[model samples]
Target chain A: MIDNPYYSHEFHGDYELVSIGRLDLEEGGSIPDCRLAYTTFGTLNEARDNAVLVTTWFSGTHQIWRDQYIGDGHALDPAKYFVVVVDQIGSGLSTSPHNASGDNAAISMSKFPHVRIGDDVVAQERLLREHLGIETLHAVVGGSMGAQQTYEWAVRFPEKVKRAAPIAGTAQVTPHDVLFSRSLVEAITSDPGFAGGEYTSNAEVVAGLERHARIWAVMGFSTEFWKQEVWRALEFDSKEAFLEGFLQPYFTVMDPNDLICMAWKWQRGDVARHTGGDLDAALGRITARTFVMPISEDMFFPPRDCRAEQERIKNSEFRVVDDVLGHLGLFAVAPTYMPQIDAHLGELLDGPA
Target chain B: MIDNPYYSHEFHGDYELVSIGRLDLEEGGSIPDCRLAYTTFGTLNEARDNAVLVTTWFSGTHQIWRDQYIGDGHALDPAKYFVVVVDQIGSGLSTSPHNASGDNAAISMSKFPHVRIGDDVVAQERLLREHLGIETLHAVVGGSMGAQQTYEWAVRFPEKVKRAAPIAGTAQVTPHDVLFSRSLVEAITSDPGFAGGEYTSNAEVVAGLERHARIWAVMGFSTEFWKQEVWRALEFDSKEAFLEGFLQPYFTVMDPNDLICMAWKWQRGDVARHTGGDLDAALGRITARTFVMPISEDMFFPPRDCRAEQERIKNSEFRVVDDVLGHLGLFAVAPTYMPQIDAHLGELLDGPA
Candidate 1:
């Protein structure tokens, strides 16, 4: 494993890894000795019924979910239910391009196999069934790329997930989102220091990482969010300072190749891929009672797109998160919409299973 | 002068350069022997009453106006008016970082002076009065940055401009727009080949330029435009092909330093700078009969922002171009909304001045 602080995975709280041995990718490739990193909070009751699965977003670790959402009286309360926050592969903590081993030892940087949200769900299924001795999850929920995984779980193993909540993400990636993901990948690969994905250190791709962060700054938030100078509330004296201090530095710690791997999967996220490109049919297959939570001002995945997919899901209910932070409200500024999110999630977890 | 075909200026038809000789900038800088590049079509009436001034947008030359809108039966028809199209400073054909001379010889690349839209208008005014021998313009018309210059001309010299049409551009840059411009500039400067603005050739920054193009692909058009795959009309088989053939190649020919200079100007675009930061007061200063045309689907300059400013102008009318190409419909896909634009400009130019 890479020992570099910048490239290696670090985490807080208690976590475990489940090796699935050989895992097959959606786009024709295999990673052997594949492993998934996950953290558990609270306790699995004697009946093992109160379990909730949380997935990580692009460039995020399970620690973020634990820090932001897993607490007493929070939307993802660890006291009421056992919470399993799983880090999707390509996230540093998992068997990403930075840490793949054994038969997957050849997979590094550009050589990493393409991963899809469905592939992630399949691995998570094995982790839950064989490793955790869990037969069913009370709910599967997350936002952004995590939300994409939530949809995959709901659609792929409907009976396994009784409830699902997908926030700030869509079942099928829109062309606009595909372009956004493509630009992020291009930003990293275009860096001359990237050296065609064979870079020695993260410092070599710092400029590209910074540019990628800037792209997120424009697309991740709403126009009203910037006009209101919301960064000031975060103690940033100026927009430039916010970018340099928060956005740029956030990406600088992650591996660029890992980001690319995840971004490619993000672009290919489509539940319809399994159902012969029939989106309605794919969404129709979801048996879980779902809460489709889309940020009201999210430019990337607008409410209209989410609501359309929600309408197609038979047992789903659409819930709009009323916040101007756009897609980022799910992570960056959660306090603004936490109450509503908590109410919806509380109802899903507490209501009849 | 740089002899590289990729970096040198090229123009169509006939154009002239008027030397203003030591033009002072709004942001505390001056370029000695400053010159404005312009081209005129049709005859200047004996009374010089039919002269119209058209300004160029970012990275555009007078040739764009000629190819897109200036023709018989067009919005900017030259048969009834003498149309003079002026290339904005920092545009390759005009005095910019790539071409600035004299005491400002060192003002190349990142050292280029910050040029405002108002600075461009002031130089254009000199070109009109001293060289073209025109006292008043029948109308000031343009789209995008050209539109910004149109507003600058009307507000800065209300008496000289009898009519104005600013399309897909605001009188002042919004915070959202400022961030977009900042991201574009960052994309270029962050390239390793950029070398802090000391690149040997445009080839050195090709990767950055390609990334820059990718950013535009995401922002230049609306979601509907992409959903509909509008690039197919231009014979592009796929979005990637379109980006490779058109968008990437479009910016590759222009000097990266010139783009940075233009983007800096774009970010600081605020007509309110002269009115003590009161946008309403600055807009109210326009005595010209104005038509504020904003693209209906434009994410950057939405109709609401343009209409808000238009409402403050005494004798201005607000018009929306109902098209899905977003900000780019004004240039790349004019057929979708050209009829309405033609009608509006026809009435503006024909109406009593």
Candidate 2:
């Protein structure tokens, strides 16, 4: 549905955008006419107890969930359960900085209100209860920034989520991660072509986006992944070819303002705010059967950090996706990557809730 | 001696700048009137064999060597062997992009020719042989990029160095490290104020330099360093204070063009070029009693990478500096930091050469 070159990307799955009315933000602002872009995979049952909510990560949409995670034979088999994949706010498919129009036109570009993980949960809560007439989610699952939202869901509305799986993300963002997020933000704003977020198109801010992609390439992949040249497995002839062919193309299509906006939210994603900085108390509220899954090689949210939070949760299991792709193994993966992830999600869903 | 505010910081040590004169670069160019900034400690013995060469790392100088590594009772004791600290060519104190003059003005700023690690070794070789009338060195020691030079010195001129130590650096740069170096270069160049390396002052490209510093803060320091708030030990009240007071100040004063020039060289530092990509054959030429020292937590040059190179050398030990400071430990230290480093050098000095 997105036609603007500023946010060009291939997201061809059928989705519907529903208005959630005027939704207020956690950071002292509100989206005038907030919207949620989502798509459902299966039919909702009479009791509506067979529904699952899959959230998207930074710069991702429901399309990726359909392509990589959802299928007939997968753990999240669409035929057996109602699979609702919702695009996170600021994602191009949703009402983002580049796509705001009509009554919401005033908040276009850099004028968009800052969004938080809690704001996203509230928005999705409205989308499901008001639009789809579903009061409870049978399961909630996501990775990276999506994982942050999954944690927020379990802690903020404990009774709503029956099962939760947050992969490659910590409940409280680390100081090291805050600086890492800050660096990504700096990379965009410092580019001359950014022009204070008034640039005409993605091409105008290509250099800044390129720098952003370079940072992601460094931290998203593990040391051994690069040292061993894993990109060759994906048909990239050389490191330079992989960089030029793979990383840059995905980002050059994205809007700079949207990326920095998401980065700002990502850095401040600490669920501990729910219980006055007491992380133990915040995690103790999670009634959902939880699986704290961290990729063993992920530098952003290492397994040790994930395990610390898992230990604090009353009934959470610490699971790991042993992939050298690190934080980014969710996509561009080997044949076994999806199965390794699905096996855990399957166990979580197939178990007692 | 480097008083130009564009490339300014505290360097109070008295150094003599000598003209090496028309040093043709390995990367197919030349510093028309090449000069090296150097400072010497103690007297060279009458045998002309008690000379020790200490090289500087990226963005470092002889002043750092004078302050942290050398002392009367230290392993590099001024009361014993003559210690010569030479600033690497692209460093501000040496013949860098910001300070090129006389006949070399044509290659100033972006016009500066790309420098190689082999180029630095050749420049130092000339300084010791042509300027000081020294034929052989008692030892050659350095950290980080200086470590690359140490490896180059031992491999290129096997008979010149008696003992060699390369700390937190690899003889052949890894592909992962090449991307890291590229990101740093892109950080500086992408800044609008850089103006294609024609910035009037360091202040003009401050944002870019700040980006450079942020990347270093992420990778130069270990993850546990930020997680445990290690900066508190150095009297930094907060993470913000540590960033503002420690990292930013050091880089914001440096010339962007000069930093990128060094980074370009750092990425291409492969001694394996001597034997056409054969690293084992290249490292096998080291006849010096060698110690390949790697900081246990250094993300830049991990111990595994250093150990791989050490295993190939004729007579070498894999020494681990079990410190948490990571790559930047070369400058910041605890009480035992120097003694631990001194112990290694002392044992190497006392052993058979």
Candidate 3:
């Protein structure tokens, strides 16, 4: 068998953590001796009040945001502000489907602890409180699933968040979102060798992962991207080459167990339920000034889903990204919406509210 | 069990066949007996020469085009042209996965008989010759997969088609199309009880069907559509109600076997291969003055794909539909492109060269 170049390798950080802590989920499960993957790009101020909490999206590790935004004078000006990005549980870096010990690793949607978006936010909050001693965050920012975390942070600990930017994200899963996520889970669970997620090896799980990737590709990008990237536009030395470049990237980059875990988490995300199903009550708790930016072409967290949340939150204002890149327009067509992002971030950072 | 209103007791004139014939699939498999299920409205003129052949899209029985387009002064104009709409093999109205007998039924992708776009055209040609006794057609028109079939008519039997309008469709499946189709197939096959097409009892293909529908929904509409349809502007009573409307439609409206068969046939479609893999050769064979209209947001069949085909054809013009409705826009937003459709169709019906 030929070596596949598309497969991503595991990365262990060079620096060791000073201390590690376990977070007991409300649903009666504990992430025992949880190892948090964290990274910093710039210097922290004397007061540490300029710290911003960056949340990761679905299928994304802490490394993604760190690579993109944690640079000098950028949206996250690491030189001026301390940026702390935490990997959510179920993601590869944190306690996850891959590295969880004993009974935890074998868990799935049915057996897995009921982890709401608030649970993820709570875990990150505990990490911040214990490790970095962050009593308050200057800003909380995220996209997609990350945006759900941003919403949770504002509502769960209103006093902690001064400003919030939830980009191409939603407050709750729409019926369509549930439908999409259900399809993804079904794609994984239906795999013959999945054996209800108790496979001794990873082969069947990877097939499910690949299926998950294809589903994501369709929903993630705009029709424009698919038009250009797939079908008629595909050109290569051979069909094998085309499959390698286009299809393999979906399955090869991520672990199979990770796909199942993230999709399970994604389906259960709810800010209102986190506040005990009182949508109005949750909205009233958010004291932070919120800027909800949903890309017009976003397939996953549609602009209108975000708009519905904008209508609920007290100090929330919404903007629609008109780029053709769909859900990924927040990242891929960043240039088109960068000015808006910069404007919102600048207004909050500079203005004395 | 909930009342599935989607499973209507057949529409008016539904399943009523107007003509019957044999569609000789020259590629080794003979559909010994083929019966076309069609509905016609308005009057046919004295001259049999004023005949229009309307093709149907995948999963869209003959009714959509015949019922919707075959009105007086409409794009099809049944008053002037004697319309002949034949249901393609493996599609609902004709021989298919649901009602198929002998070797044709229960066919999987690997087991499915190789039926190309040319097979559709040839079958329709036989329908026109043996049953209708029409020497020539005024125009051949269809949308999406229908357009694919229409394109086939123009090239397969050049002398038969005087004009052709293949709308909201591509010249061929793009790399993205292949990827999506491959994923859909995997989703169905991965179902444990699928039992490699051997599972006759207690098999749950609904999960696979649901996955296929979700993918189809993602591809059919833009993000704006989901926001409008599923989120902010939804009319459904609950999230479950909305999902039933959004996700269940595919499973309820189409059989799992039918969806797979349609997808398989779609994957096998290659008009370029009909003329020995030389696209120019296929286009060269088309003596019909062709008009190709591709929807702007139709990622499945982008305007560029249509233009490439138009460029190959001897006498062909291309029109671009600027609508966010995506592939479905051809039918959903028909008013915008109808004038162009009418003009091209009228010119073709004038007379044979």
Candidate 4:
């Protein structure tokens, strides 16, 4: 395990490497002895009936969603709920570009196995069932990319989950989102040093990766944010100072390989495939009570998209979070929206529909 | 004049090197006989009563708005008005980093002549009265960067212009716009080949500049645009083909030097003295019956910002143009908006209020 001294005691989670036998990739391929990185907080209880699966946003680790909402008296309170946080495939902690099982890890787009968000849900299911002996889940909660995983879980295992909260996410990535995410992936893979993703000796494409991060940052924030929150208050001694202070920090936080893989996965997200291309039909398969929270300024999965998903699901509630934070608002300004998220969780966790 | 064989017309526009006489730099400094590139369309009537000054957008040549709007029966029609287009100082066509009159362009943050949008208006006023025998303008019109010029005209030459139409723009760029533009300039100037803007070899940061263009293309268009208009329909036989077909085309349209200068000008855009620090007081100077037409999906200048400007100007009218085209909508889909802009121009051109 990687040592992190700054690790907070606020999240006393347990980590484990579970062998899930093999990964059956979408390209008619498979990888044997696939090990997954996962963490669990709270207690499973005697009946193994209180498990809540938590997912994370893009560039987030299992530590992310776990720390924010898993303590006592919180929505996924460790005192009562057994919360499982699985690092999704392609996220550095899990099966990822940085840690391929074999030489194939360095494979190019043509050779790399196609792993969808559904594959992530499938792999997580195996970990839960085989390792934890949990046959049912009280809920699945996640935001952004993790929210996507939550949507996949509801459709993929209708009876397994009793409730779900897919916050600030969508049922399908709109064509525009697909374009943006794909461009990010292209930025990484197309760099000359990429060498078909097999140039292990060359330094990674820091420039391309930084470009991707910069583009992502633009989409993540609302125009009003920079205008009102930042702008006037911030001044740099030089233009270079401004970029180093504001731009480079975001790039440093992300790993290039992981960014490429996850962006591809995000673009491939589609709940309709689980129900044979009928989105409404896929939503119908969701037996869980769902709270679909859409941020007011999230242009990607806007309130309109959330309302559509809510309309399709029989037991779904559409709660539009009003904030200028845009898509990142759910996390960056979580404190403002958490109360509303918790209130709905309280209603669902209290009783059956 | 650069010859264009495609149109089969020798570009008859006259190019002149004008001495702005001098610039008393913003930081209590001065530069003398500052040269600038300028071009004029239409005949300056004997009375010089029909002179209409047109301002160019960021990276825009004296063409586009010059050819598009300065013709017969159009708004700012040269048939009734002598049209003048001023190339911003830093552009390659003018006395910039590319071709300074004496020493290299004063680019030092301190040596950098703090030329605001108001400065451009003031400079053009000097050129007009001294060289063209024109003391007043029938109107001043611009889009994007040119819109900044239009705003400056109202602020600096409020009595000189009878009317003004600033399209798809705002009175002030949002902080996000400033940051993004600043980032692009950094990308260009940071290239190792830049050598403090004096390198003889090709720019080392050419790739970064290309990346900047790609990012700008994405930002300037609406989400629906990438989805429906551009990327979706593009089918490439290979990744290399896709990059060339889609990506390279965008970077090719704008030159790196031009892009750098335009972006710098954009960051420096302020109708009033940024140093003076009283934004509202400066906005109070616009006396023209201004028509501010902001496109709803314009990522650069949202309609709400236009509304804010309208509220600030004493004699301004606000018109919101809704289109999925974003910032480019006013330029690309000009037909829908042109009629409305022309209607407003009709009232202004008919006479002064």
Writing each residue's lDDT as its tens digit, candidate 4 over A131-204 gives 99999999988888998999999998989999988988887776667756755665666565565655452245
Maximum-lDDT candidate: 2
Instruction: Give i-RMS (Å) per prediction.
Output: 1.5, 1.0, 2.8, 3.7
TM-score of chain A of each: 0.96, 0.97, 0.85, 0.87
| CAPRI quality band, candidate 4 | acceptable
List ranges where model 3 is wrong by over 4 Å.
A1-35, A72-77, A102-110, A230-258, A268-297, A302-353, B1-44, B64-80, B96-111, B155-167, B198-206, B221-226, B229-258, B268-353
lDDT of 3 by residue, B1-353 (tens): 11223323254245444334444554555554554555444444566677788877877766666545567776567656677776666565565545544443333323445456677776677667766677788788888878878887887788888888888876566655666677677776676655564444313566666566666665666545554553233456664564468555645455545556667667766667776788788778888888787877675676767787888878777867666557766554445555655665566555453
Q: How well is each residue in A1-353 modelled by candidate 1, as lDDT tens digits?
A: 33437533343455787798789877888887788889899899999888899998888888778767788978688888899998899987778887766667788767888888888999998998888878899999989999899988887888888999998899998888999888777778877888887788778889888878878888888877787788888899998898899989999877888899899889988999879999988888898889999999887888988988999988888999898888888774646688888888888878865
What candidate 1 gets wrong by more than 4 Å, as runs, is: A4-11, A45-47, A101-104, A108-110, A332-334, A351-353, B4-11, B100-111, B195-200, B332-334, B351-353
lDDT, residue A84, model 1? 94
Cα lDDT of model 4 by residue, B74-116, tens digit: 7667677788888776554555444443543454221345455
Residue range with the least summed lDDT across 10 consecutive positions in model 3 chain B: B1-10
TM-score, model 4 to reference: 0.83
Candidate 3 reaches a DockQ of 0.36
The lowest-lDDT stretch of 10 consecutive residues in candidate 4 chain A is A1-10
Model 2 reproduces what portion of true contacts?
A: 0.77
Native interface contact recovery, all models: 0.70, 0.77, 0.49, 0.33
Write model 1 residue lDDT over B175-200, tens digit each, in one string.
88888877777777777888887787
Q: Pick the candidate with the highest DockQ.
A: 2
